[model samples]
Target: MLIETTAWGKLEIDEDQIYHFSKGIPGFEDVTEFALIELEKSSFAQLQSTQHESISFLLTDPFNFYHEYEFDLPDTDAEELDIKDAVSVRSIVTIKEQLELSTINLLAPIILNPLNRKGKQVVLHKSSYLTKHPLWAGNSILDKGGE
Candidate 1:
């Protein structure tokens, strides 16, 4: 299947690579189908909408930045996506003037059950995490290659 993406142009992806999000991402409730495009040599991946060319999100493993980052995955929400145990957790990233100034959205992480190809963005109601937590202590995104 071919999908038009804003960042990657025309992309050919397998049918199984498409993810169905019953509740879509926050603020994007209309788009529920997305394809995860792996970025070159980087932990970041493009969560591109297969329906809209402009609807795409840059996602990354939050643990790459905040190792201690942990949150609750309510059983109720997990059951909705049919998530039993294993999960693919990723956080949305907001790039600033420079890559070194980027911030990760640890407050709400996207959790996906690959076995079912279903996902949901769970927002932490009361938590210390932030939507724009600095990528690291200081200038580490470029200094350490975001490792």
Candidate 2:
């Protein structure tokens, strides 16, 4: 199938690439359908909304940078998404003018049931994870900017 997007324009994709977010993101409740597309020459992926061209996000696997990153995996969420196996946990990333200044959201992770193409954003209620975690080890973890 082919879907038009603001980020990537029109492109061919498979049905499996489409992700359904029942409640959508925090501010995007009306836009649910989206497609996860890999970015070229980068580790990030685009979670592009199929309905709204302006509603999209860049995501990345939290473990890629923060190996010790984690949050409670509730059984209720698992049951809701029917996530039995092949779970894809990704975090939303905020890109900056400079690549190294980009930050990723660890407080809320996007969980996916790959088998059923179901997806949802799980916000950590107990953890101290911040919404804007640095994507790289910016200057000995002291500086507020890029790595």
Candidate 3:
């Protein structure tokens, strides 16, 4: 299918790329459909709303930036998405004017069930992660041996 996006203009996307968000993203509760487009040679992907051309999010695999990043997918969430085997996790990224100041929202990760094309932004209620973590903060920790 073809969709218009502010970032990429008109583009062709596959049916498998489209995901259905039952509860939608945090603030976009009404928009239930989005296409997950991966950026070549980059860890980032664009979650573009199929309905709204301008409504899109920059997402990245938190693990790419933070190797130690871990979370438990509540049983309820797993069942809701009908996740049987394949699952994709991505964090919303906020890019700043100063590239180094970019932050990623680790507290709430976008989870996708590839098999069913279902998605959700699951909030980690018991996690120590914050909504905005410096995009490159993990480098310092690794540089200091996780001190």
Query: Number of the top candidate by lDDT?
Result: 3
Model with the higher lDDT, candidate 1 or 3 = 3
- lDDT by residue (tens digit), candidate 3, 43-145: 8999999999999999999998889999899999999999888999999998877676678889999999998899999999979998878888633432333
The lDDT values for all models are 0.86, 0.85, 0.90
CA deviation > 4 Å runs, candidate 2: 139-147
The list of candidate 1 runs beyond 4 A from truth reads 139-147
Best candidate, TM-score? 3
| lDDT by residue for model 1 (1-147), tens | 999988778989988778999878889999999998888899999888999999998999998888899998888888898887779999998888776678888989989888988988999888987777777666545445443
TM-score of each: 0.90, 0.90, 0.91
Q: List the residue pairs that clash in candidate 2.
A: none
> Candidates 2 and 3: which is better by lDDT?
3
Question: How many residue pairs clash in model 2?
Answer: 0
Q: For each predicted model, how many residue pairs clash, with residues at least 3 apart or on different chains?
A: 0, 0, 0
lDDT of 2 by residue, 44-96 (tens): 89998888777789999899999998777899999989987689999999888
Residue 141, model 1, lDDT:
52
Regions more than 4 Å wrong, model 3: 138-147
